[model samples]
Target: MAEEAGARREEAPEETIEDDDGYVEYVPVKKRRLLEQQKLLQRKGQNSSLVEDGRGAAESKPSLLVKASQLKKDQPEISATEQLVRQEKDMIDRLSERKTLMSVRELAKGITYTNPMQTDWRPPSHVRHMSEAECDEIRKQWHILVEGEEIPPPIKNFKDMRFPDPILRKLKEKSITRPTPIQVQGLPVILSGRDMIGIAFTGSGKTLVFVLPLIMLALQEEQSSSLGGGEGPFGLVVCPSRELARQTFDVVQEFTNVLREKNYPELRSMLCIGGIDMRSQLEVVKKGVHIVVATPGRLKDMLAKKKMNLDRCKYLTLDEADRLIDLGFEEDIREVFDHFKAQRQTLLFSATMPKKIQNFAKSALVKPVVVNVGRAGAANLDVIQEVEYVKQEAKIVYLLECLQKTPPPVLIFCENKSDVDDIHEYLLVKGVGAVAIHGGKDQEEREYAIASFKQGKKDVLVATDIASKGLDFPDIQHVINYDMPAEIENYVHRIGRTGRCGKTGIATSFINKNQSETILLDLKHLLKEARQRIPPVLATLDDPMDNVEEVARASGVKGCAYCGGLGHRIGECPKLEHQKSQAIAGTRRDYFGSGGYGGEI
Candidate 1:
């Protein structure tokens, strides 16, 4: 019976098996019965042997087999279900892992890395850099205008104007053959004792416009003095900078020289500036000088010290009025205005008339006549303006190229004193003769630099805006803007350095991508006012990728093969290889090292 039960448990369907409440039981099956019958027949021979032995062993074995089979069959469904659940869980885990990886990859695509120490990063391009060819073209064009174009004939009908013999002789000696438009228009009002505002370009001969009338008035006053000595500041000409004051004083002295030559008494002129001794100026003041040429600050200082009095000043001239207002001199100018009596004649001259200056004029000048000449501080129609886009790093490179290609005797204007020094040093290293001038320089140093530049001892002058107005260097053939001026009028002053006295000259401005749009707009407006034809390329919008690297690649030039160490080629280099090598190895070691190690170690 046990054997039958064991066979039935092994063959039975797994789902029908169960545990008993009181006793374990197995249901009989037809297959199990057949198996039992066969086993019985096969064991018939062994049965007789088993009968002799105990049946206990066989029965025990069958019971054990039945129990083991029942246990395994009971657990089969649970084991299979657990395996299926584990497989499903594993599949979900793998899918989640795959999604995580995709997310990480997507995040990585948008990220970037930056290294602050990397020198390879490109700088924004500067707007003041220009190409050599472009600079030359501009120079050529301006020279043509300066030489070929006839300035509009001076306004006629001033022959009957009354003036002192000394003043007339000086005017005739300087070939004041005909009066300029400003002179023609402004002289009448100035002579009529009416205040006026004169707007003109730098080289439009505006200085003479007021100077001529002031001198005539001073002479008339001197002649009328019964005591043979004029008193109480007969004429006062105030300028923005000490250099401008000195310049005006020099011009006025020229007129005085002509006066003395004609047997007229010397016109006493006092120069009041910061660097010169104030005591000396006070001494001149005590002696009662007829005319005073001074800067605003020094003039104010003198007035405050009570060392000088302007209570009776009849004629007052403010040159570079626009610059004064721009430089925050409004308060100082107003204070100076307060010192003068209301009946005084005030003449205001500026290259441009911005709103601030116009407002200042309204308060300063009484019913002033406004005279605008040569487009009113625009690029002198005589001056040719050309701009080149270049990388700031390559600015020096382009400047050297321009200097090489064009003529010498150039004036280079920088934005600051440090820039002037840097450019001056750079030019010297390149074997280019140059000098630098700035406010930091002492009067003697400044005077020497200007003298050197004017005397042709230096081929290039790198200077701050201090050298912009009134300071004239006659032979300057080119003006290269190492940096753009802050104001449009400053640009006019800088370019005005060249192309003076009816001589054609060139002004080369460097423009880079990083330049301020406000400055560019001002430049555009200035160009339009001058009636210059704008280049189509400059008129177009700049590219976003207009960076320093692109500009450098466009403007950079490899060292000339012929010149070796020099910027020019070997054939063009004035020095031989041995001399060039020695110079580069010794005097220019720092410059070459800055570029990178150049010589063989």
Candidate 2:
């Protein structure tokens, strides 16, 4: 009988066991292991000197009162840390209260002013708006200009801007106390709830210029019970490319989290771009989102499928607006604009404002306040630029030689995907740690490449113009245009990726005659202004547009209506293809009118 009982016990499951209570109970193995760990930790805690006397013997830590008293006496650092935490919590609570109050005021105002088109409604009489001269002085001081209109004065710091306490504290925690030039002028305009066109160089803190105000506006609207009632997002940030959209999404998410931590309503953001599962994005939208950062195509796809809406999207921002337009997103942008019905505020931010961008802004923004930090199409002055007049065939050899001396974290921009891939492969084969990012790569590969580059896992990033604009990797030491961009403005954005946020950086370009002719004058001017070496090849080239002969011939202004010549009028001029064709046709008609060539040759 004893042997049979032993055999039965061996076969029984370990989860259920009989105790002194004479009952069976179930306990998982994981639970048992966790219990063991807890008991071991308790034993160690009790043996440590940090625990106070007279507390329970099994208690693993000191009493709050004891810890506080000791923190005040023996550890000043601990007290200061505790004070900071408390202050952060207190600020969150206070901001929450202020948000609630603002919501109530907005609700009351809505009751009185219900017109949808009344975006120009004035604030109370106590508010004193900045005068034109004052605004101009502020702009002049910062070397900025706003389109012939007065704006709210620039802020020197977060406190001067009167941002919410939580945001201010968060800024302090991040050690970003001082405002950049763009933020100094851009923030006040955005906060005024007016449409704005902000033009600043890359990495000039343009993201914050729009993001901070969007957060405040969303919070206010949320408190007033204006958002979250619809399937549409309250804010839409349209980026030119998927990488830029992803980076901007991160910034918006970080600020959104800060607002959530302040006890405000939880704000959800969705990043909609290609190279991802469309169904997954749809599901995220279905769950509810308040803000969207997206590329144009994917955003249009979502709209077509009815997965998302922009009916209630009050804040519309175009980051890198020029790039977005140049990349053939203008039609989709217009379509997206048509969906908004509410009193929406539009913001267009770009590094350069060309004529097309200016026209787009005119149609989109209603009397926008244009803010330009520096000359349009100009490169950031912080970069040390170098132009080498290398032959096309020897460009690769020169690049390899340059890499031998260049430091890590170098970014090389090729003109096309093939070159990007070839250069990346060459670098890898040479035992150099390198990664590549371009439109040709799928979403996963692009993400991994960017992640590797950003985290210092990869020392070199070989890319095309797709990585040129609005993708912030702040620590890049050098930018090399292995193949110079076709557009002058692209060169500016490409190099602006380095020398970010007042940090000095180096930018080197390989220029050949074929690539330098059209932009020689502009390149010369840029090099001279940046105090860089102007190559002898570049110095000898004349401006193609400035030559009087070339201008007269190329302007398409027909000096002679008949012959299209500058020396003679239509009647006296010789070479006229249209006139010759017409004269031949008339002779043929006269012959045909008498009797046709008909069957004859």
Candidate 3:
């Protein structure tokens, strides 16, 4: 009976479904018992036509991502802004598609400075291979030390450094008789095309170290081939703050202007920062830029908008690296880095290099030379640090008394914007020349305040920690901290505003019961390290740094090595915890949503 049923199935012919074109195929599907077996045995047929119009199908279109990928392909109408952006993207794509003509490696990379530089003046290898005593003497005299394999010898004088006469004359015009400690060693490392991280005091001429090399780099690139429209930024300077960026831009302009006056190939530079006209920056970039000094936000925005490209950028300098990360520009910085297809000779310069930052910086560069002028996070010896304990209510009143200690060109730092304004208003009412700046102020007001202060029109510039990050004030004699900063690194920066450029200055900080013991502990150790006078309130705080090693070994939290805070370990660190919470809160928003310190200041 089973054989008979199989034979009947073979004769049924229900499996092969044929189309009108006569092509037939068998589709095997699960067989189910049905009450109407005869109806289930029917064959299924299809319309055989598979062409576009032959089938019931509509015309296809490019997907969102597909349409987005084609920059110049036919598409629907777009706005003027979109068209401009598309043009920029097309320009950047063309730049990236250019063929590489040569392969290069670090340590000069066969790219010698010849336009205005004298490579014939390079010191002989034997002279470069100085005896240990001579090297030690140079380092000791400058209080600078370097760590790396095959490190370049330090430059003794501006003349010995192979700099073009024009650059040297410009230096002399600026009254810079010789190289600072950082410039002594830093210039060689950078000029050799090696990546480097330079640590020095805030006012120790760190800017020149990167700037001079950048100028030389751009000069060489121009000598080989002039940058066409939408081509350059052979070098990039990333500053954390706008004021610092502008200062760098001015320096670049000064040197580039000197070169231009001498009738050298014009090296164009642009300052990309907030509060500036974007159209102006776009014009500069469109014309072609040899160097760009920019704040992280504006630079990142430009990169995102495809308005600028870093294909020709072989030199990258991050000024105030620690502050850049602290202000939450690390991601933006790395994103800006993604645009570089070629290798970059990266340099990171700052007054402080924390343990965490040091590690992260290493990962960003290719075998960097580390040149440290003093202990990382250590206060400047030129500044006399004094901590005073005062009640929160009476702190503002005592500020007047503190201002009397220093003459014109004073910086008063408060932790809050309201406090900065209140102090500024109070000082004005009390007949003290004061101007205020913070995150809350608009660009015009902040620039005016900084200009007033720098030109010495305003003796007292009341500000927050924003002013402390890499803003150079050569004549600042005193720095008064109205309320202590939350992080110890900020303390170093606040005090660093004074005591710059071979001059002695004073840094006075006020603390109250509201201040954290962690901050106090770090303050105590910093003062002790600097040999400054520690007040009674700070002196009473136990020194966590004393047994830091033992505690670190026991707890495995490393005892706050990240910020050099002696009061706690990494696990229990309030600053770190605050960072984690801020990161979780979506973005690193400032305490008051102003993106300033605690309260937008």
Candidate 4:
């Protein structure tokens, strides 16, 4: 029975043991081995879970690193873009400021006095005013023949003149008629030992104005042997440019030919300019000459080298006085003037007078007469003025168009040397005949270019303001300002190149939006002072003529008491019919006709 019970228990599924209520437990025969197996299974499961968790953590860490790196890289790009945007804004602001300053400068250009005809104006109290009757009486007196009223006819035989016999003979040979107006007016004053100021337009016989006086002085010095037996120069004529000095010397030489023929010849002159041999000039100075016509820079050098002496200079003339100052030669001019004896007779001749020039005269001139023959501080009336508003980029294109429209032999003025060459090259590329002259070129090149231009080898001469004044290019049909001058007075000089010797011509200025308001104002004032009608397109909102009706209402336009004309004031109206009739008939016939009609009988 015991064996049967044990078998049953063993067979009872190796019966599970109950540790707690209703719980079953199993036991293995190799107890150590079983426990080891169970422990190994549990450790394997736990290791699996740990490995999965570690993989997730590693993957998350890599993603986080990538995101942080991306953020770091993006930060700099954003900052750089911001910096670039700020820089662009700053540049824009600077450009705006420059534009504003330029605008103000243009507005202040050339303002002058208003015309009396256009407005009710009065002369300064110090100035004398004359009535119509008084002016008419003076005109009549000018025509009357008083004792010795007639200029004695020039001596048929030049030998009878007081000049050296040879010079007189030469004058007779050349058939030089009477002295030109400038020569007549300027020579006597200079010879009388008085400081003089000559105001004449270009080619209005101006060369003769100073040249004749210089020649006479030279002649007197030669006759009296006042040169101290050496070639020490007796007179010094300073011009602004080398080309101008050469031109003046050439004219003087021509005049000297006549003097030479009359036996008062042997006049010697030296030319000192740049792009020439300084040693050769020094040699000439050492040899001594009666006259020296030079430019400022070269003259200054020669003076420094002791190659020229001005302490004994008896005559000093500043030709083209306005140009000398305009070119920034004021200091050089002052230095030259200082070198001369204070007692020397100085002549300052200019086409226009500005405040700077007036101040210069006050400092340099000694109580001189201001001889303004034609319109003062204005362009020559004979020059037909025209202006075209164009874009800066299109200037070259427009210049070419203008050249095609106008006749050849045009003088075009630029503001810069590079512009001269640039336009010159552009014209050449367009198969146009053109030449350029500027400060950058050598003296010989300039001379050759000018000569070519003068000889008609080139149809157009492209030059800077350097060629604006003191240049005599006869037969120039037009003067085109490719670049308007910075100053209004420069415009006057530039236009003066045309309308020379009473020959009418055209002056065209190209105006751009960038042009200064000062320049425009000055141009307007200049036109007004010259009695010219300003073009409506150029008229600004402030122009009196723009609101003529308004201005007329404010001023109360009235008819003249003399002629009942709307354009004239009560006291002022030209008697056109009477003046026209009197002008048509010679003065003698007009006087007789007016007086002989219905005699006292």
Model 4, range 1-601, lDDT digits (tens) per residue? 9898668667864355464677655566696577678889997777677768785444333468899998888875544434533543343344233222111112244222121111112223321244545533532432311111111211212222234555444545655555434443444445445566666556566676677667777776677764643346778888988888988888778777766665654777888888898877776665568888999999988777766777667778888876785566766776675565435666777776543354445444444544445533457778888888888999999888887656779999999888888999999999999889998989888999889998999899999877877888878879999887766657888998888776888888888777765466557656665566776645762432332334334433322222222332222223333434655764556356554665532
What's model 2's overall lDDT? 0.73
TM-score of each: 0.62, 0.69, 0.76, 0.62
Tens-place lDDT per residue, model 3, 1-601, is: 9898578658975555455899766444444234235564442112223233465333344578886768547667776545544543343344233322122332225432212212223555755779878877888898887887667788778777777788889999989998889888998878877788899877889999999989988998899889999988899999988888988999999998988888889999999999988999999988899999999898989998999999888889999988887787766876787787677788998987766676667656666789999877778899998888889999989888888887778898988999898888999999988899998999899999999999989888999887988888989999999989999888888888888888899998888999888888878877777888878888777765564454445433333646656455554568767866876765645544766654553
Please give the TM-score that candidate 4 achieves against the real structure. Answer: 0.62
Candidate 2 RMSD to the correct structure: 35.7
How many steric overlaps are in each model, in order? 12, 0, 0, 21
* lDDT head-to-head 1 vs 4, winner: 1
User: For residues 3-75, what per-residue lDDT tens digits would candidate 1 score against the true structure?
Assistant: 9878887896443455576554564698577777878888776766676687635543446889999998887
- Model 3 residue 27 CA deviation (Å) reads 51
lDDT of each: 0.65, 0.73, 0.79, 0.64
Looking at candidate 3, what is the lDDT of residue 445? 94
In model 4, how large is the Cα lDDT of residue 261? Answer: 63
Range of the 10 consecutive residues with the lowest summed lDDT in candidate 4: 112-121
- Can you write out model 2's per-residue Cα lDDT over 1-601, one digit (the tens) per residue? 9898578667974446676888876777797898789888988776664445645557565789999998778854544434534543353344234322112333445522222222322333323465667656766888886673545667666776767787888888876889988888788777877778888888889998988887776676666764443375878999998899999989888888887888878777889999889887877677667788899999988887777887778888998887776565767877776566556778888886653355445545555778888766667888989888889889877887877555789999999999999899988898889999998889999999999999999999999988988999899879999987766678888999899988988898888866735455557767765678888987787543232333234432222322112232223323333435765876777466543645443
How much is the lDDT of residue 366 in candidate 3? 65
Comparing candidate 3 with candidate 4, which one achieves the higher lDDT? 3
lDDT of 3: 0.79
